[model samples]
Target chain A: MLRIGLFVVTVIGALVAAAPLIAIAGSNPLSAYRALLQGSLGSRRGLAETLIAATPLLTCGLAVAVSFQGGLFNIGVEGQLVIGGLIAGAIGAEVSLPAGIHVVVAILGAALGGALWALVPALLKAFRGVHEVITTIMLNYVAFSVSTYLVSPGGPLVSKTQPSATEKVKATAHLARIWQPTRLHLGVVVAIGLCAACWFFLYRTTAGYRLRMVGANPTAAQFNGINVRGVVVRTMCLSGALAGCAGAIEVLGLHGRYFDSFSPGYGFDSIAVALLGMMNPLGVAAAAAFFGMLRAGSVLLQAKAKVSKDMVTVISGLVVAFVAARVVLERRLESSASRRDRRRRDG
Target chain B: MADVFSINLVVSGIYLSMPLILAAFGGLLSERSGVINMALEGEMLFGAFSAVAFTWWLGSPWLGLLAALMTGALIGAIHAWLSVTLRANQIVAATAINLIASGLTAALIETVWGKPGVSPSVRKFGIVHIPLAGHLPFLGRIVERLTVLDWAGLLLAPIVWIVLFRTSFGLRLRSCGEGPEAAASVGVAVISVRYRAVILSGMLAAAGGAYLSLAQVGVFQRNITGGRGYLALAAMIFGKWRPVPVLGACLLFGLADAFQFRAQVAGVNLPHDLLLALPYLVALVALATFVGRASAPAAIGKHFIKD
Candidate 1:
C-alpha cells in the first residue's frame, strides 16, 4: 500500500517538476502530455514500439536491481552492455553454425564478454575493498575507447560497407520477430522470462537469502559463516551477465549488428528505473514500461508538441529526484497523522 | 619525441590542469564537510552552459563567469537541501542532479540557440601576463600566457588549504564531517556549516567550468566537461582528500593528457583511442594500488539526524 502511494506521489511530482520545462518550450503541459500518451499507447503500432523499447530497459533494470539487492552499485552496466553487444555482433558475423545453435553461441559469447568486463571491478571491490563506483565509471571510458578503436576506419571488426559498425549479424542468429506489421521480436519474451527467473532467484533460493543478508549487514553475515567476498563477486557477475543480455538482445533483435553508439543511455536510465521500481522485479517491469513509453513517444512529442526529446530526460530526472526525497514526504505524512491522533485523544 | 617535453607541452599541461585543480578542490570541500558530492560533474556542466549562455546573451565574458558562479551556488543549495536537509541518499540525489543538468542544458541549448549540440561562439577571457613572472626562468615561459582564470585555478589550492586548515569555520566543518552528532552536542550548527561548505564547493566547481567555456574553448558544446568532473573526483581520492596533494594529482593527470595530445601529433606507435584512455587507466590503477577508505573522513556518506 505504501509502495503504491510512493509511486503515485513520484509520478505527480515528476509531472509537477516538468511543467516548467514544458512551458519553456512554449507548450502547454496538458497538451504535451496528451501528445505523449497518444504517441505511446493510443495505437497498435505505438504499443509495439513501446514494448520494443522496453525490452532492453527491462533486462538492464533487472541487472541494476540485482546489484542493488547485493549491496553493490554496478554503474558499469553501460560498459558491460557495450562489450556484450560487440561480442555478440562479432560472433553473429564470424561464426558459422546452424540456425538455433548460432543464436545461442552468440548470446553466450556476449554474456561472457560482459562478465569479463565486470570481473575486474568485482574482484577489486571484493578483495581489495576498492570502491566499485569509481572503478566502474573509469572502466566505462575504457570500454568506449576500446569499442571505438575496434570499429574505427581500417580497424578490425569495421564493416566493409560501414566504417563505424560491424558486419551485419547472420540471419540464422537474428531474434525472430513475433508480431506481424511490427518490429517486435523474440527478445521481449526472453526479457520477460528473465524477469520471472530473476524474481524467483532473488526470492525463492538460499543463495538469494545469503546475498540479502550480506547486503543488509556484512559484518553479521560474515560472522554467520557466509562467504561475503565470494557472494559479492558472484552478484556482480550475475548483474553483468544480465546487462550483457540487454546488449545482446539489442544487437540480435533490434539493430542486427553493433553500431558505434546504439544505446541512448539505456543503461544509465535503468538505474533510475530500478530505483523507481523499489528494486522489485515486477515493479521494475512497470517502471521500464513507463520509461519505454516516454522513449517511444518522444519522437511524436517532439514533432507534435514542439518539445525536445530531452524532455523525457528531464522527466526521468525529476522522477529520480522525487523518489530520493520520498523519505521527507513520508515523514511529513507520519507527523501530520500523529498530530491528528494526539488532538483526538485530547478532545 | 623532444616535443613531448617542450616548454609548449608544459604550458599546455598547466592550462589543462587548471579546471581539474579547481574542480578537485570543490570535491575536497564538500567531502570534507561529510556530504558525498557525486554531482560535481552535473554542477560543472551546468556551470559551463551558464557561462556560455550568459556570455552570448549579455555580451560580456565577466558576466558569464558571474552567472556560472551564481548557478553553481544554486545547484549546490539544491543538492544540500536534498542530501543534507532531507537526508536523502547522497549518491541517488547526485545522480538526479546529473541527469537534470544534462537534460536541462541540452534542451535549453535548443531553446536559446535554436540549435542542438553546440552553441554560438561568445566573448572569452584573454591571456593575462603577470607583471614580473614573464621575466623569470623556465617557470616564466609556462606562466606568461596564462589566462586570469588559469591563475585563479592555480592559486585556489593554497587558499582552500588555508581556509580548510587554518580557520575556525573550517574546523567546525571538518568536525561535522568527522562527528556531526558530537559537534552538534558542542553547540556547533552542523547542518548550516555543511550547507556553506557545499555552496562554496559549488562556486569553485563552477569557476572551473567557467574556465573551460570562457578560457579554453570559447564555446559551449554538449557534454563538454566530458567526465572531467569524475576525473577530479578520482584525483581527490588519489590525493587522499588534501588540497595540495589533490593539486598535484590534477597536474599529473593534466600532464598525462598533454602527453597524449603530443604523442598523437608526433605519430607515436599507439592507437589514438588508447591514448585517450590513458589517464583513466592510470586513475584506475592508482586507486587499486594506493588508496583505501581508511583515510576518508570517519563520518563521510552518513546522514546525521538531530533529535
Candidate 2:
C-alpha cells in the first residue's frame, strides 16, 4: 500500500510541477493535458504509437534496471544502443540468410556489438577502479563520431540515394508489422517477452542471485566466495546487450535503416524510467509505457495547444526529480500524519 | 603544424578553455566539500539559457551574467537540498538536474523566442584591453583581446588555490569533507559549510555558462555546453581534485580543441566527426590513467546524518 501511494504521489507531483511551466508556455494546463490524453489514448492509432514508442524504452529500461541491480551505472547505454543499431543495420543490409534466421542474426550481432563497446569500461571499472560513469559518457561521444563517420557523405556505409544513412534492411531481416494501418510491429511483443524473461532471470536464476549479492554488498559477497570483479564485468555486458537489443529493434522495426542521430535521447530517458520503476523489471515496463504515452501525445499537444514537444522532456525530468526525493517526501507525509493523529487523540 | 604553434592558436585555446576551467573549479569546490556535483553540466546549461534570456530581455550582457550566476545558485540550492538534506543518491539527483536543465532550457527557448534549437543573439561582452599589454609582443596579443569573463576564468585558479589552502574556512571545509562527524565533534558547522560550498560551486559553474553565452558564443543554442560539463568533471578527476592541476588539465583540453580547429583549417586528413571527439577521448585516457579512489575526498558522496 505504501509503495502504491508513493508511486501515485510521485506521478502527481511531477504533473503538478509541470503545470506551471505549461502555463508559462501560454497554454492552459487543463487543455494541454486534455490534448495529451486525447492524442495518446483517445484513438487506436495513438495507442499503437504509444506501444511502438514504448518498445525501445522498455528494453533500455530493463538494461538500466539490471545494471542498477548490479550496483553499476551504465550511462553509456546511449552509445551501446547506437553501436547495436549500427551493427544490426550493417548485418541486415549485407548478410544473406533465411527469413527468421536473418533477423535473429542481425539482432544477436547488435548485442555483441554493444557488449564489445561496453567491454572497455567494464574492464576498466573491474580492474583499475576507474568509474564507469565518466568512461561510458565519454564513449557516447565516440559512438556518435563513429556512426557519423560511417554514414557521412562519401563514407563507407553511406547509401547511394539517402543522406547520412545506410542501405535499408533486407525484407527478410525486417521485424514483421503486427497491426495493420497503425504501424505497430512485432518488436513490441519481443520487448514484452524480454521484460518477462528479465524478471525471471533476475528472480529465479543463480547468476542473477550472485549479481544481486555483489550489488548489495560487494565486500560481503567477496567474503562469501563470489568473484565480485567477474560479476561486475558480466553485469555490465548483460546490461549492454539489452541496450543493444533496443537499438536493433529501432532499426529493424521502426526506421528500417541505420540513420545518423536516430534516437531522441531514449537511452538517457531510460535511466529515469529505471529509477522511477524502483529498478524492477515489471515496474520498468509500466514506467516506460507512461513515458511512451507522453511521447506519443506530445505531437498533438504541440499542434493543438502550441506547447512544444520538449514539454515532455520537462515532465520526465520533473518525474525523475520527484522520484529521487520520494524517500523524504514519504517520510514527511508519515510524520505529519502521525502528528495529526496525536493532536486528535489529545483533543 | 606551424599554424598550430601560432600565437593566434594559443589565444583561441585559452578562450576555449575558459568555460572548462571555471566549471572544473566548481566541481573541485563541491567535491572538496564532500558533495558529488555531477550536476555541473545541468547547472552550466541553466546558466547558459538564463544568461541568454535575461540578456535578451534587459538588453545588457552584464545583467545576463548576473542572471546566469543567480540561476546557477538556485540550481545548486535545489541539488544541495536533494543530495544533502534529503540524503538522496547524489548521482541520481544529479541526473535529474541534468535532465531538467536540458528539457527546461529547450522548452523555454521555444516559449521565449518563438523558436526551438537556438535563441536570438544578445548583447555580449566585448574585448577588454589590459593596461600596457598591447605594448608587449606575444603577451600583448594574448592578454589584450580577452573578454572580462576570460580574465576572470584565468585569474580564478590562483585565487581558488589561495582560498582553499590559505584560509581557516578552507581548512574547516576540508575537514568537513574529510571527516564530517569529526568536524561536527569539534564544533564546526559541517552542514552549513557544505551548503555554502555547493552553492558557490553552482555560482562558479553558472559563470562558466555566462562565458559561453555572453562572451564566447553571444547566443544560446540548445545543449550548447555539449558535454563540456562532463569534460570538466573529467578534468577534476585527472587533476586529482587540485585547483592548479585542474587548471592545467583544462588548458590541455583547450589545446586539443584548438588543435582540432587548426587541423581542419590546415586540411588535415582527419574526419570532422573524429576531430570533434578528440577532447572526450583525451579525457577518457586521462581518467583511465590518473584517477583512483585514493585521490577523492575521504567522505565524498556520503550524506551526513546527525546523531
Candidate 3:
C-alpha cells in the first residue's frame, strides 16, 4: 500500500512540476498530458513504438537489476552496451552465412563484447580495491571514444555509403519485424524471454541465492564460505552481457547497422527503472513499459505542444529525485501511522 | 622560441585547470565532512548554465558568478538532504542528481532561449594584465597572461590548504568525516557540519562552472562542463584529498588538455575521436591504478544514524 502511495505521489509531483514548463511553452498542461496518453496508447502505431522503445530498456534495466542483486552497481552499462553494439554491428556487416548461425554469432559476439568491456572495472574492484563508480564512469567516455573512432572517417568500420554508420547487417541476420510498417520486431519477444529467464535465475537457482547473499551481506557471505570476490566479478559480467544484448537487439532489429552515439542514454535511464522496479525482473518489465510509453508519447508532446522534447528529461529527473527521497518519506509515514494506532488503542 | 612555446603551453594549461581546481576543492569540503559528493558533475552543469544565464541578464560576470554559486548550493542542499538527513544511498542520490541536472538544464536552455543546443554568448570576465608582471622577464610574462580567475584559483589553493589545516572549522569537518559518531558524542553537530561542508562544496563547484562560462568560454552549452566534474573527483583522489596535491592534479589534467589543443593546432593528424578521448582515457588509467593505493577518509560514505 505504501509503495502504491509512493508511485502515485511521484506521478502527481512530476505533472505538477512540469505544468509551468508546459504553460511557458504556450500549451495547456491538461491537453498536453491528454496528447501524451492519446499518442502513446490511443493508436496502434504508438503502442508499437512504445514496445520498441521498451525492448532495450527492459534488457538494460534487467542488467542493472541483476548487478544490484549481486551487491554491485554496474553503472558502466552504457559502456558495455556501446561495445556490444559495435561488435555486433561489425560482425553483422562482415558475415554472410545461414540466418540462424549468423544471428547467433552476432548476438553472442555482442555479449562477449559487453563482458570484455565490464571486465576492466570488475577486475579493478575485485583485485585492486578501486571503486567501481569512478572506473565505470571513466569507461563510459572510453566507450564513446572507441565507438566514434571505429565509425569515424579513416577508421576501421566506416561506411562507404553513409559515412557515419557501418554497412547494414546481412539480411539473413536481421531480426524480423513482428508488425509490418511498425518498428516492433522479434527483439521484443527476445527481451521478454530474457526477463523471464532472469526471474528464474534470480529466485530458483542456488547460484542466484549465493549472489543475493553476497549482496545482502558481503562479510557474512564471506564468513559462510562464499567466494565473495568471484560473485562480484561474475555478477558484473552477467550484467554486462544483459546490457550487451540490449545493444545488439536494437541494432539487429531496428537500426540494421552500427552508428556512433546510437543510444540516447538508455543505460543511464535504466538505473532509475531498476530502482523503481525494486530490482525485480517483473517490476523492471513494468517500469520499462511505463518509460517506453513516456518516450513514445514525449516526442508527440514535443511536436504538438511546441515544447522541447527535453521536458521528458526534466520529468525523469523529478521521478528519480522523488524516488531517492522515498526512504525518508516512507519512514515518516510509517512512524505517524504507528503513533495513530497507539492513540486509538489507548482511547 | 622554446621559452615562448613553453610559456604559452603553461598559460593555456592553467586556463584549462581553473574550473577543475575549483570543483575539486568543492568535492574536498564535502568528502572531508563525511558526505560523498557524486553529484559534483550535475552541480557543475547547473553552475555553468546559471552563470551564463545570469551574466546575460545582469550584464556583470560578478553577479553571474554569484548566481552560479547559489545554484550549485541548491543542488548540494538536495544532495545533503538525501544522503545526510534521509540516510539514502549516497551514490544513488548522486546519480539521480546528475540525471536531474542534465535534464533540467537542457529543458531550461530550450525553454528560455528558444533553442536546443547552446545558449547565447553573455558578458564574460575580461582579462586584466598585471601591470608590473607584464614588463618582467619570461616568468612575469607568464603570470601577466593568466586570467584573473586563473590567478584566483592559484591563490585559492593555498587558502583552502590553510583553512583545512589551520582553522577550527577544518578540524571539526575532518572529525565528522573521519569519526562522525565520535564527533557527535563530543558535542559536535555532525549533521550541521556536513550540511555546511556540502553547501560550501556546491558553491565552490559552481564557481568552477562559472569560470567555464563567464571567464573561459563566455557561453553555456548543454553539457558544457563535459565530465569535468568527474575529472575534478579524479583530481581529488589523485591528490589524496589535499588542497595542494589537488592543485597539482588539476594542473596535470590541464597540461593534458593543453597538449591536446596544441597537437590539434600543430596538425598532428590523429584520428579526431582518439584525440578527443585521450583525456578521459588518461583519467581512467590514473583512477584505476593510482587511487587504489590512496587511503580515503575512514568513515566516508557511511551514514551515522543517531538514536
**lDDT (tens digit, per residue) of candidate 3 on A125-229:** 888777777778878888988899888887899899988788999988898999988889999999999999999999999999999999899999999999999
Clashes of 1: 0
Chain A TM-score vs. truth, each candidate: 0.94, 0.94, 0.93
Cα miss at A11, model 3 (Å)?
Answer: 3.7
Q: lDDT for model 2, on a 0 to 1 scale? A: 0.90
Q: Per-residue lDDT of A1-347 in model 1, one digit per residue for the tens?
A: 88877887787889888998889866788888988899999899899989998999899999999988999988888889998999999999988999999998998998888888888899989987777877888888899899999998877899999878999999999999899889999999989999999999999999988988888899999999999999999999998988899999999999999998788888888888898888899999998998999888887888898888888888888888998899898889899999999999999
On DockQ, the candidate that comes out on top is 2
| Per-model CA lDDT versus the true structure | 0.89, 0.90, 0.85
Residue-wise C-alpha lDDT for candidate 3, range B207-278, written one tens digit per residue: 898898889889888888878898899888878888888899899888887777777776676776777776
Q: What's the number of clashes in each of the models?
A: 0, 0, 0
What DockQ does each prediction reach against the true complex? 0.70, 0.72, 0.65
- Candidate 1: where are CA atoms >4 Å away? A331-347
| Residue B88 in model 1: lDDT | 95
| Residue pairs in collision within model 2 | none
Cα error of candidate 1 at position B256, Å: 1.8
